[model samples]
Target: MSGRDYDHRRQMGGELIIPALAVCFTLYYFTTIWNSPWTAQVSAFSIGGILLLLCAAFFIKTALLLRSSEASLGLGGLVGIEDVRNGRLALVLATIGYVWLIEDLGFTLTTFLFIAISITALGHGKNVGRATATAAVMSLAGWAVFIWAFDTRFPRGWFETTMQGLMANG
Candidate 1:
């Protein structure tokens, strides 16, 4: 099959949105940090430049494929055909919920719950034991590092408040 004779409807055209957004963001970031200190802006500028170049290359390649009638705007097929799409959506919603509840649940509990839920959801209920153990270890390790090693003051919630009250009374 020649490049110009292929059906345009089955190509991965929908994947261009991310690169487009990255290009826009890189441009905006450069404009905002153009006058900042070189040391402060150096890393961002370098990364942005690289991102811009890669996005340009991808966009150009996609455009060429489209122009040659070798690609179709089959965005629906790309995301709709995936079996793990629902899992991905669930994980995203869970993440948003995790962030929203962090203040009320506090870091340790919220993080632990989030990690456990994420692992289970992404695993599709398979290997439940492994997911649970990994989530527990990861959550506890994160908490230890941030609270004990780094002394980061996470927000107080029910657990923290109850512990503090108990310590004060005892």
Candidate 2:
């Protein structure tokens, strides 16, 4: 194959992939808003506007990439596609299990397990000790940010009462 043929193939692949992704996003955006129970006119308009903006942005990006000459459609540039595929599967399974375990184990336990498993699965640690420490710190940081800074309430699971007591004391 000639150089021009290879470039044409690459460009065509890029164009195809991006438009497909944009179409999927558009479909999801419509489905979500259509199914949502936003009965109030103002609420429906707000949600619809946001969804439209998201879809517009996705299509705009795809269009820009398709117009660009420098873009390549091949997956070769992205790192750890195989690892990511495996990691994603593991993440999904772990998320489901975590939801089930939350009632029995509590939020802290479930979150910690999920974070550690996810980080490790994403090819985080060559050293066991380092990985454990990193996971611990990340879990703690996430907890602090969500609970303290954002004032967001997560499912406390079995620890609900205890967390409430702590919050009251604080």
Candidate 3:
């Protein structure tokens, strides 16, 4: 076969990160909801069960793809260009930080920050102002829809509490 065909073949390495993370998160989700109400448990298990099946399917696909002689296990597939690697890493950090801080910061504020940071990172700082504006609008809309309209069980922080108070009084 040609070198071009060889290069076009399979690759792995950090490709496993996403599936591994999905499995871990699904498992954690299952573990946390054990004491939850039956309805909640049923919903969580249904979704997590799908996630596990998907991960299993992905792993099987990866295994089959790796069976090729041209398969590569290099880390190059993690991020294509070296320049954007930092940006991707920043985005990853932003996601981790978002998950870690969402409970304390409230849904609106945390979503705003996460979206802003993500946009800025992906845009390479070329659109920070626009990112901030978009983040604000999106976050407020999320609050209006999820917290105000639907009144879902999202974690409440300063913004949520203050907004609830304003709406109650006014």
Candidate 4:
């Protein structure tokens, strides 16, 4: 009945959200691949099962922490940290934009721009040159591995289409 006890319970409840989400996702994944071949579903099944167990362990630990009155349950400290909130929001928005633009710009170009901008944004707008160079190298390496080494097809946007056309004509 003490205020301290109430606070501890609330914090434990807040910490439970992540484990709850993991459990939900694991169940969803299991159901989706339930009918697939064992070879195709093995990785998903293994990873999902491991994730579910980890979540269960987390839930138990948090519950025990609350029972022992070692921590408060309020979520404000975690979710209300202003600097982290802004950075996380920006990153999420950038990721959304990257996904939206990928079809039009193609994977290589879109990923390059996304990585550069994400690095700069996450770094609080410092070190633009390094971010750009790193992004370029990563994007090119990914393109080479996927397109050349693996011989997988990615969507072709304007630049890819133009290059293909030029090669055909020549």
Indicate which candidate wins on lDDT. Answer: 3
Compose the digit string of candidate 1's lDDT tens values, residues 106-167: 87778778888888888787787887788778766866677646758976577556655776
lDDT of 4 by residue, 93-160 (tens): 88999989989998788889999998988888899999999999998898778864675788656755
TM-score of each: 0.57, 0.43, 0.59, 0.57
Per-residue accuracy of model 2 over 12-93 as CA lDDT, tens digit each: 3434555567556656666666756656345656665676676677567656765664445554423356655657767778
Candidate 3's displacement at residue 7, Å, is: 5.9
Sort the candidates on TM-score, descending order. Answer: 3, 1, 4, 2
lDDT of 2: 0.64
What TM value does model 2 have?
A: 0.43
Query: What's the ranking of the predictions by lDDT, best on top?
Result: 3, 4, 1, 2
Model 2 misplaced stretches (Cα beyond 4 Å) = 2-8, 11-15, 21-81, 84-107, 144-151, 160-170
The local distance difference test score of each candidate is: 0.76, 0.64, 0.87, 0.79
- Candidate 3 accuracy as lDDT: 0.87
The clash count of every prediction, one per candidate, is: 2, 0, 0, 5
**Model 4: per-residue Cα lDDT at residue 63:** 71
Model 3, span 84-104: residue lDDT tens = 755887888899999999999
Candidates 3 and 4 compared: the better one by TM-score is 3
Query: What does the lDDT read for residue 130 in candidate 1?
Result: 85
